[model samples]
Target: MNSVFIRKALLLSAVLFSSVVLSQTQDEVKKENPTVDFALEGRIGVAVGDKAVGINVGGPSLKLKLNGFKIGVGAFPSLLVLDGDAAPRLSVSPIIEYKKWMLITPYYGYDAEKKMIWTFGIGYKFK
Candidate 1:
């Protein structure tokens, strides 16, 4: 039973990795798969400092973005560390993203607990 859970977890990890790697950017998706109405995206970025929250600038942070919207949770505390702090700040944000014509997508969201913040980034999305 324990081995079954381990196998499932490992398989899930592989799927996520494959999605992130095989996914095409916005342009490609719009050009080839226009029929695809929504997408599931995985976001990976550096630990940019938050002025309002005073978070120590350090490593990378990963989050799941859905349908290009700002309604996702941070997927941190993985096997690899994404921040310098020992205890990760497991915060959730409900962001409102503005996807421009270009590849970049600018977002304005609050950390709810910390404060308001502005984030501009593009991520890999797949079906």
Candidate 2:
């Protein structure tokens, strides 16, 4: 069990570090072509479902803005704190953002127990 946790922690760290590097590269590309609109932002929010309510953290979203619409996908690591037993999970969801408000639907989450769950969430994004 300890080994599993350590592995997960390491994997998460690598993902986050890679995302930051990717975001920086995108910024440089955007500077060269002003027509391309790309953004990376942090998100934090709460999710609730019939079985559980959880807090979402480390939600790094890569977004594209066209006209007035923003669309993206985010990977959220969450803690299901209100469930029968607290569990850590990762959720990947399609995201739509207007201003700072974010809507996440069909949030597909995979937990340590290898259970898959679908839920919906609302969140705020930080610029």
Candidate 3:
């Protein structure tokens, strides 16, 4: 009975020691390579294509940055000021940012005529 108790105690100690060592090594690895970051960004730009011409207002966008490049998606509400008439619609687009410049492509949305359109635009990102 005493031998069995000793074996169980040794096994528990070994498990605890290995777990602590593994956690410390993981923390060290994280410290050595801290390259990813996240941020909220907003942008405004003018878009014109097909039957869509408008001002894009994007905000509260979640961005993932790795190294020097950033990638994200934003839902932008566009104010279409076409032919002296104004209307509002939402567009979701993929955003690519480098430094302070932003690129929004395949800016897909519906026009005042309820027709699908694609537009692309460049703008500045606010930090």
Candidate 4:
């Protein structure tokens, strides 16, 4: 009876090991699949020292393969609030992204007064 129990334990161990190895092999193959593509990223970054709140919205932006690139527009409005009146200060930035992550854009933005400003930044893929 003891010998039978030992044999059963060994068989179970062998089966578990085989399953793990097979899974690893399959994962490697999937990684090398050329047809497989992924593009989806979302990040929250801050710009300090400007004393202004920055909001960036960029994601699944797509690479040059699709539409040559994607667009990323950001806005920063003044944070002043007073007696049913708010000072409006809006800034717009249009960015071009590559591979749905690498954001390489030179924007012609404007403030509430329509003043022009330049903005540039880089991004990373997270998917």
Candidate 5:
């Protein structure tokens, strides 16, 4: 209820504040040092199921952002909580990211025993 709203507000505030701090520091660094070519990005999402609420946090994924095109790799894993029961899974994939307002990477995961699965996500580049 109110607590969920409060928590979301706090998380959003923290992200914005951090982004400002990072942006300022990065700007200063560029004036003093050569630009770096690497960045890390990730996604967090809430997954809904028939009887459960789940959470996901994936990637501090590494990428090479050169001339506005990025190529990278990352993994996604999630925990599902169902009426006190839990299930978990992990999938790894290579990703290709493009800059369009923000960075979006579309991935197709291929595990040795599993079929190829496709996923799409956005990334924030730091540095």
Candidate 6:
């Protein structure tokens, strides 16, 4: 299964398990509902490797919360003005978040030379 599907399955399992473990009676179980969270933020980071040093730029990021689950999308661009000889770079990341503001984001990127790229990052929400 794709990452998205796997994440959804895990979230479903977690909610079901929590309901079972926390429920003391039928009434309490029926009252439990997942809460949603929403946020707008910016991210800054860099891509570094041998031969060239790349700078990271800050970009808009979004998060949507449902129950204890969150789904998010972010886009980042590298201006390349500092490193003209380096590879071209652009990136997009779709992410999933869980309880306590923990986030997992797997990213795809491209260089100016059209090489395959990948990245993974973990984040936390403070607000």
User: Candidate 6 lDDT, tens digit per residue, 27-64?
Assistant: 43333465865665544444323223344444466879
- Candidate 4 C-alpha error for residue 64, in Å: 3.1
Off by over 4 Å in 2: 1-41, 106-115
Best of the two (1, 2) by lDDT: 2
* Winner by TM-score between candidate 2 and candidate 1: 2
Query: What local lDDT score does residue 8 receive in model 4, on the 0 to 100 scale?
Result: 51
Candidate 5 per-residue C-alpha lDDT over 1-127 given as tens digits, one digit per residue, 9 for 90 to 100: 1446445544554465345444643233244564775654556544333234445556556778887556666665655455577667554444444432122222223334454433323333333
**Residue range 1-127, candidate 3, lDDT tens digits:** 1445445544554454345434543232334556976666666866555445668887557689988668888788887665567777677777776666666644555545666666656656666
Candidate 3 segments whose C-alpha is farther than 4 A from its true place: 1-42, 82-84, 106-108, 112-114
User: Which is the better candidate, 5 or 6, if ranked by TM-score?
Assistant: 6
Per-residue C-alpha lDDT of model 2 across residues 76-122, encoded as one tens digit per residue: 88877534888777778777665556666435455457655555556
Candidate RMSDs in Å, in order, are: 15.2, 12.8, 22.2, 21.6, 10.3, 11.4
Best of the candidates, TM-score: 3
Give the local distance difference test score of model 5: 0.45
* Better model by TM-score: candidate 3 vs candidate 4: 3
lDDT of 6: 0.47
Candidate 1 per-residue lDDT over residues 1-127, each given as its tens digit: 1445445544554454445545636554236657656754443332222332122221233435567543433332211122333333433322222242111212224443644443222333223
* Candidate 3 global TM-score: 0.55
**Candidate 3, overall lDDT?**
0.62
For candidate 1, the clash count comes to 0
| Backbone Cα, N, C clashes tallied per candidate | 0, 0, 0, 1, 0, 6
What's the best-to-worst order under TM-score? 3, 2, 6, 5, 4, 1
